[model samples]
Target: MATEIATLGGGCFWCTEAVFQQLNGVLEVESGYTGGQVANPSYEQICEGTTGHAEVARLTFDPAVVSYREILEVFFTIHDPTTLNRQGNDVGTQYRSVIYYHSPEQQETAKHVISEMANVWDAPIVTELSPAETFYKAENYHQNYFRQNPLQGYCAFVVAPKVSKFRKTFSDKLKQF
Candidate 1:
C-alpha cells in the first residue's frame, strides 16, 4: 500500500475534516495548524489571526485508491477558493484557502487544479499553494468535531452542508461503511 499525506486549509478545519473523512482512500483526517511561525500554536492563537497559522486538516491516504488530483478536485468543490481569508462567515488569515503540498508533484497538481477551478468560479482564485510546513495538531476536541457534534450550530449550518455537497458530488468516491 502506498501512503501519501495532504495538508489543506479551507476555512474551518471542522468542515474540511468532515468532507475528507468520507472519501474512500483517506485513512485519517487530522485537524491541525500549519503555515505559520509558531512552534505549537493553540486554537486560540490561531483564531486571533496573528500566528499566521491556518486551521488545516492533514489527511493520510492511499494513492492507489485516490490520486492527489482527485483530492484537490474535491477540495476546490467544497470550499470557495476565490474568497481570500474567508469561507462563508468565517474570516481571518487562519481561515484562508491553502494547499500545503507534500511533494513537487503535489505542488504541480495543486497549481493545475487551481487553474482549472478558476474557470469554474466567477472570481479570481486566491488559494495559496505552498510546500508542506510543520503541522501542529489541534486540540483533541477538534479532531472529529463534525462527527462528534453534528448537532452543533456551526456544524449543522456550515460543515454539514459542505459534507452534503461532497457526498452528492462524489458519491462514487465515498468509502463503504
Candidate 2:
C-alpha cells in the first residue's frame, strides 16, 4: 500500500510518538531528530539544545485511511502550538512545535490547517511549517518509549496525559486492539 510521511515535533518525541501510534491509519511512528545541522545527532546533543534539531516523531501512514489534513488536526489538538520553543515543562528548541511537510500538497494542507487552528487557539499558533529535512532515527531506547516504560516518571506524568487527551479527543480514529 502507498503511504505518506508526516514529521512533527509537538514536544518530547515520547509524547508525540505515543499519541500518533494510537491513530488507526498511522502505520508507524518513529521518534527522531531533524531540522538540525548535526548528522546523526545523539539524544544528549539534542537535549543540550545546540544541534538545532527538534525531537520529532516521523509517522508513516496510509493517506487513503486518513487524510493529511486529519493528521494535522490531530497534531494541533495533542500539543500546545502557541508556545515558542517550549511545551509544558519541557523548554527548549528541541521541544518546539513544528511540522515538516514532505510534498507541495502536504505543505499547502499544513498551511491551511495552521490557519484554521489559529482561530481555535487563544494565542497565535507558533508551529513552524517547513520543508522536511534529513531525519535521523533516535536511539533504540527512544522508540516506543511510553509503551515500553509506561510507569517511568516522564512517561507517566507528561506523555500519558497527552496520549489520554488524544484518545479522548479522537476516539473514533483510534486503531483497533
Candidate 3:
C-alpha cells in the first residue's frame, strides 16, 4: 500500500488520535510530541507549556484512499483553529492547533485548506504550519488511549464527542471494520 504521513496537533493528542484512527486510509496513528525545542519532552513537560512542544498525532495513511486535503478538512471541522494555544478547556502550547507537514506539497495543501476553511469560523483560523520535526513518541500509556480507556473521564467526555463528530460527519470516510 502507498503510504504518506500527516502530523497534526489540534488540542490534546488523545482527541486528534481518536479522531483520525476512525478514518479510512489511515493505516496507523501514533500519539507523539513535536514542534518543540525540547529533545524529549515528557507529558508533564509538555503540559507545562514551557517546552514549546505540541501534543501531536503522527498518522500513516494512503493518499490514494484519502488525500491530505481531506485529512485537513476533518482537522479543521472538529477543532477550533482560530483560538491560539487552546482547545476547549485544554490550554497551553502543547494544546495548540498545528500542522507539522512532512513535505512542501503537504505544506501547500495545509495552507490551502486553512484558507478555504477560514470563513467556517467567525474568527480567522490560526492553525500553525511547520516542517515536521523530531517526533518523540509519547509514553506507551498514551498510545491508543481512547481505544484503551474509552470510559475514562477525559475520553468519555472530551474525546468521544470528537470521535462521534468525525464518524457522523464523515461516515463515508470510515473503514468498513
Candidate 4:
C-alpha cells in the first residue's frame, strides 16, 4: 500500500484531527503548526496569533484504500471552507482554512476538488492551497486531543459534533469504530 502525507488546517487541529482519525486508510494524524513565519512555534505562540501560523494536522494515509481526492471530499464537508481565516467561532489566521499540498499531484487534486465544491457551496470557498512546509508536531498534550479528552469542554461542545457529523455524512469512508 502506498502511503502519502496531507497537511491541512481547518480551524482547530483537534477538530480536524478527530475526523481523519476515524477514516479507514488514514494511518496517522499529527496535530501541528504550519504555514507560518515562526520557526518551531509552540501552541501558546500560535494561539497568540503573532507567529502567523495555522493550526494544522499532518496526516499519513494509505492511498490504496482512500485516495487523496476522497480525503479532500471529507475535508470540505467537515468544515466551512467559505469562512476565510476562521471556522465557526474560531477566528484569526491560526484558524484559517488551508491545505498544504505535499506535491503537484496533491495540489491539482486540491484545486479540482475545490472547483467541484464551488457548485455545491453558495459562497466562495476560501480554502487556501499551498505547498507543504516544515511540520513541527505540537506538544504531546495537543496530540490525540479529541480522543484523549472527549469530555473536555471544547472537545465535547465542538470537536465531538464534527466527528459525529463526519461519521454520519461519510459512513462509507469511515473505519470500523
Candidate 5:
C-alpha cells in the first residue's frame, strides 16, 4: 500500500499526536520537532524557543484511504491556526502553527486548505507553510504520551479537551480502535 507522510506543528505535540492517532488510515503518528535551526535539539532546548523548532508530529497514512486534504482538514479543525507562535498558554516559537510540506503538491494543498479555512474564520490565519526540514524524533518518553499518561495534569487539562473536540467533530474519520 502506498503511504504518505505529513508533518505539522500546532502547540504541544501530545495534542496533535493524540488527535491523529485516532484517525482511520493513519498508519503511525510520531511526535517530534521540525523546521528548526539546531541539530538534534533536546526537548529542553526546543522548549527554550531558541532552537527554532516547532513541536510537531510526523504522521504516516495510507493515501488511498485518506487524502492529504483530509488530514489537513482534521489538523486545522483541532487547533488555532491564527495564533502566531503560540497555542493557549504555551507561548513560544516552538509552539507555532506550522505545516512542513514534503512535496509541491502538499504545499499547494496546504495553502488551499488554509485559504478555505480563512474564509470560515474571521481572524487571519497565522499558520506557517514551509518546506519540510529535518525532523528530529522527540525523546522516547514523549511518544504516545497521552496514551501513556492520560490521567496526568497536562493530559487531562490540555490534551483531553482537544481530543474531545476532535472526536466530536471528526467521528466519521476515527478508527474503531
Candidate 6:
C-alpha cells in the first residue's frame, strides 16, 4: 500500500506522538527533533532552544485510508496554533506549532489547513509551514513514552488528557487499542 509521511511539532513530542499513534491509518509515530541548524541535536540541546529545532513527531500513514487534510484536521484540533513558539505550559521555540511538510503537496496542504483554521478563528495562524528537514530521533526513552509509562506523573497528568481529547474528538479515525 502506498503511504505518506507527515512531520509536525505542536508541543512536547510525547503529546504529538501519542495523539498520532491512535489514528487508524498511522503506521508509526516517532518522536524527533526537526527544523534545526544542528546536525543531530540531542533532546537536551533542543530543550535549551539554541538548536532552533522543534520537538516533532514523524508520522507514517496510509494516505488512502486517511487524507493529509484529515491528519491536519486532527492536528489543528489537538493543539493551539495561535501561540508562536509555545503550546500550553510549554514555552520556547522547541514547543512551537509547526508543520514540516515532506513534499510540495504537503506544503500546500499545510498552508491550506492553516488558512482554513484562520477562518475558523479570528486569531492568525502562527503554525509554521515549512519544508521538512533532517529529523533526529529523540533518545530511546522518549519513544512511545505514553505506552511505556502510562502511570508516570507527566503521562497521567499531561499526555493522558491530550490523548483522551484526541480519541474522543476523533473517534472515527482512532485505531482500536
- TM-score for every candidate vs. truth? 0.99, 0.99, 0.98, 0.98, 0.99, 0.96
Give the per-residue Cα lDDT of candidate 4 at 1: 67
> For candidate 1, lDDT tens digit of each residue in 34-137?
99988898988999999999999999999999999999999999999989999989999999999999999999999888889888999999999999999999
> Per-residue lDDT for 1-177 in model 5, tens only?
889999999899999999999999999999999887889999999988998899999999999888999999999999999988899999999999999999999999998999999997789999999999999999999999999999999999999999999999999888996
Checking candidate 3 for backbone clashes, the offending pairs are none
TM-score of 5: 0.99
Report lDDT per candidate.
0.95, 0.95, 0.93, 0.93, 0.95, 0.92
lDDT tens readout by residue for model 4, 1-177: 679999999999999999999999999999999988989998889989999899999999999989999999999999999998888889899999999999999999999999999999999998999999889999999999998999999999999999999999999988886
lDDT of 6 by residue, 43-89 (tens): 88988999999999999999988999999999998888998899888
| Local distance difference test, candidate 4 | 0.93
Q: Which residue segments of model 4 deviate by more than 4 Å?
A: none
Give the Cα error of residue 69 in candidate 6, in Å. 0.5
> Which candidate, 1 or 4, has the higher TM-score?
1
Give the clashing residue pairs of candidate 6, or none. none
- Backbone clashes in model 1, listed as residue pairs: none
Q: For model 5, which pairs clash?
A: none
Give Cα distance to truth, residue 132, candidate 1, Å. 0.6
lDDT of 1: 0.95
Report model 6's TM-score to 2 decimal places: 0.96
